[model samples]
Target chain A: MTKTLAIDCMGGDYGPSVIIPAAISALQQHSDLKIYLVGPQQELQQHLKQSPDFGNRLHIQDACEVIGMSEKPSTALRRKPNSSMRKSLELVRDGHADACVSSGNTGALMALATVLLGTLPGIERPAITAELPNRKGTVTNMLDLGANIDASAEQLTSFAIMGHVFSQLADDVEHPRVALLNIGEEAVKGRDSIKLASDILSNQSQIDYVGYIEANQIYDGNVDVIVCDGFTGNNVLKACEGITRFLYDQLKTEFTSNWWSKAVSAMVWPILRRFQRRINPDQYNGASLLGLREIVIKSHGSADSKATLFAINKAITEIERQVPQAIQDQVAQLLLNTDNEDEE
Target chain B: MTKTLAIDCMGGDYGPSVIIPAAISALQQHSDLKIYLVGPQQELQQHLKQSPDFGNRLHIQDACEVIGMSEKPSTALRRKPNSSMRKSLELVRDGHADACVSSGNTGALMALATVLLGTLPGIERPAITAELPNRKGTVTNMLDLGANIDASAEQLTSFAIMGHVFSQLADDVEHPRVALLNIGEEAVKGRDSIKLASDILSNQSQIDYVGYIEANQIYDGNVDVIVCDGFTGNNVLKACEGITRFLYDQLKTEFTSNWWSKAVSAMVWPILRRFQRRINPDQYNGASLLGLREIVIKSHGSADSKATLFAINKAITEIERQVPQAIQDQVAQLLLNTDNEDEE
Candidate 1:
């Protein structure tokens, strides 16, 4: 089936320079994919002219306004009615596109998506679920990366339900293993909020709750889904980025220090490249807004052309799998089974 | 001047096996250091028998009860009156030891330290502060790594004040640059509590507040002290550990996969070892329970002998610098200023 995507070309840091090329790369990879590039017409025209792949399948939708990277979500929502981010989300809401991809202000993107596409039944707040390569070469789907801060126990359980559905659709995992992010793996550890969420998750037959997983164990790839409140999820995601950059920077400095070390570094460069490729987080650049009524992928705002391509491909995969429908079905089933679970 | 340290030899994953040897090594390194080993006398004697550095300075303080790793802080406080953890904290409170180092349940350590030593004047709650390697070959001190959850806006500013004092005293950093850990560097980014804390930090003349810092920039080492509430602190600390281990593991596996790679690895092994030593987080172990009346360092529960020695050194350094007294003075000064800081 043909899949149409709405790309927010003006949203990311690099604007048309990086995103347009990424859209071109996506079209080349998925021959049947159609993209509606939403941005300023002249700017999008210049980039499209540079690419040989522009055709009728590649439609251009001009948007007059944009949401700045540092703009407040509330302000953007009230002010920028013609923003590329809003226009792209509108495409998905109006059934013109199967999915939407944006590299825009995270808060604005989330606010606009929630207002336009609404949310699946039983999901009070939408979440941002992103994948990162783990030790076992399998990806871990961690959710609520920045969507909702101080999430309640019921909301955490809802996140688990959505994450479990994602693992099944994206990774084809049976009885997808799930775990809550905590300070310690022990039950008596973390704060009261985490303890409450544990009770809810433990009783859910639909989610294979594998107990708590610590931050150090996140990349172990033992669990398919890791759920947490937005504060924790956002910090964990950024901390990983900080450490990865430090290691690579240190290794580079070590290699180029002296002539003797440089000779050895040249010899080992290929092996190091292989190591880098295996652990590069850029390949996992896109995150789907999981509990939304329609699929919307948020690309890293600072992503390069290659990373942006990976995010677009993520959207293609979600469209093919009908991820929104799958999540809605699972959540409806969970809500239908009336269980007066303990009041958290 | 001589410094006395109380070691909870019964605590940690390896118990006396790692702690006793580490104490002996610390004694050898610091001739003026005295260590009171708190544990069952017979077991501590058996471990001490292997170390040749034991002398009059190495005294054993017997504590019959042991706090299990899984024991709850509150329960252990009520049940185990003679626990090694309690005894170590008592030694500091009674002035028998200038500082205490424990590798027990973090919650138990924090609880016992707060109850026995009490908070310094103007300090509401105690916090755990530790360091991690940064890209600049220096370390970043992050605090409240699980000691205090849901910290108020005023409490966050107080954490910054304590961390700033620590940076100056421990690292000899003059006018130490401080930053509030947030999701973004922008002033309007992060939640209400964080924004409130930022306002307090910015207006304070005593602190060199560098504004907000994101997680991905933690290793950049631009700021000396990074402050946050316990939840974000714990998650960020652990996330760094997870990513570091993953990268190192991947690099090792890549270097040893085949004969050709092994040959290249052998040539670069020396350089890799040098790089590892420079960035090894083990050297940064030993978290001080700041804001308390007495100095207490929490060693990593799974620390090996070498890591424990480093932690002991940390305690010794704090004792020499009179960290508790320094914090007490600064906090009292801040309180005397009579600012109506917005109620959290």
Candidate 2:
């Protein structure tokens, strides 16, 4: 089946400078891929003039309004009737695109996706899932990284189901081990919400629900899916980003200090590059808003061409693997089970 | 006034290898300082043999028990009657030592200190405060970084007061601006507990409460004192540590890759060392458990001699500044007002 992706061309810091080239590269690499670029037609067309196949495979949807990064998410959505993010979601809603990719305001994208594309039948909230690189060359899928801050127990259960299906479909993990993030490892430890969620998850047979996992165990590759409320997950993700930036700055200062150290630095250059490639944020770009009827990948706003390409690739993989369908199937099973329990 | 610090000799990873030398270094540097070393007599005495005036400045208490790093904190006090951590707290309780310092399990130390020295007259759980390095040369004081996992409104109010006093004593801020860590800057953005705590903090006359501060503002240097529940605080701190470690590993790999980069690295060695010193975890080694009657500093379990010495210096400073006394005065005033209001 041919896969078509709706791109928010005007989103992100570098805008078309990064996204345009990336879309072209993605289209060139993936022969089955067709991109419907959504943004200001004039600017997008001007940028597309440089590409050879701009008219052949690329389609444009005029969306003049843009959501500024600093704009209030709710107010922007209400005020800007023809924003690119909204139009992209509309394309997915109308079956013109299999997936939507944007590096725009995350809150705005989430709101637009929920309103336009709508969530899966039994899903309460759409969770954003990011794949983090583990030591064993496998990625650990973490969910609700910031889609919903205040989540109910039922929402958390939905996140686990969506996270499991995403991992299985996109990452190809069969019966993925799903673990809830808690302060402590023991099943008894954590707040009432976490404890109650654990009990609920343990009883659900559809998911391979493992016991509680501590924050420290996140990098150990012990579980395939780690789930938490948006507040905790966002904090953890930001903290990880902040620390990485801090350490990189510190190391840059260290290596450039003296002559002898610099000489030694040259000898180990290639190995270092290999390691950097392994952990680069660009390699892990594109967090998907799982549980939505259509696949929507949120790329980093500051991403360059490489990172944008990674996000586009992620969108392709989601469409090819039928991630949204898998999530819908799981949610249907959960709803049926809930109904059965109520009857009993 | 003489300042005496109770040192838990058998607490840390390397124990005496680091603690003994650090204590000696601190003593030599601060002439007014006196140390009450609590551990087994034989090992401490043998280690003290290297210092000629050890007997004159150092007093040894034969506790004969040590708390293991991995042991459950709740069981440590009752299981081992003469555990070094318990004995250290007792010294402070009996007024034999003005302050106590340990590099053992933090949970155990907090439990023992709460049970032994007790909280300030009307205070709830004592808070753990640590000074984190911000973007500027100055530091920001953060509290409840992992003392009580679940904090009530009253406990949060106490934390705010204690955190203010801690910054005044350590960071030397006369009227520190205290802020609650919340999901957003708005008062209505967080959980009910956070909203109640924010209300209480804003109304308090003693503390210079500056309203809600979001996680993004944490490194912005706007607020001098930040307070949150232990679970959230712990997650933030650990996430920071994890990210720092991740970046360090990534950068080291990046800088050591090639000859030209190594040459540049050699020239920048001194500058890099200065940067390392600025963000060194060792420089900010000690954490104070506030709201306790006696001052207690918790050092990292894997701390080296330099980190241990930093902890000792922190203990001596707290003792000299009479941190406990300041907290007592603040709590007393708060209690008086509360009692009067209740009576009315």
Instruction: State the lDDT at B197 in candidate 2.
Output: 84
Writing each residue's lDDT as its tens digit, candidate 1 over A145-222 gives 988867988888889888988998999998899999988888998878789989877875667899999988999999
DockQ of candidate 1 compared with the true complex: 0.79
- lDDT of every predicted structure (CA atoms): 0.87, 0.80
Worst 10 residues of 1 chain A by lDDT: A335-344
Q: Tens digit of lDDT per residue, candidate 2, span B66-125?
A: 887657677886898898889888988998889999998777898889999888887878
Off by over 4 Å in 1: A338-344, B338-344
**Candidate 1 lDDT over residue span B255-329, tens digit each:** 899999988888888988988887777888899899998888899888999999999999888887889999888
lDDT, candidate 1, equals: 0.87
Q: Quote the lDDT for A158 in model 2.
A: 82
True contacts kept of 2: 0.24
- Positional deviation of A84 in candidate 2, in angstroms? 3.5
Instruction: State every prediction's TM-score relative to the real structure.
Output: 0.97, 0.81
Tens-digit lDDT string for candidate 2 (A1-344): 78999999888998888999999999889888889989999999898887976445789999999987656668656999899888998999999999999998777888889988888898878988999876545889998888887677788888888888878888889989999887656554456777787877877577899978766567667799999888778767765665555455555555555786566556545645665676677889999999888899999887999999999999988887788887788779866775575456
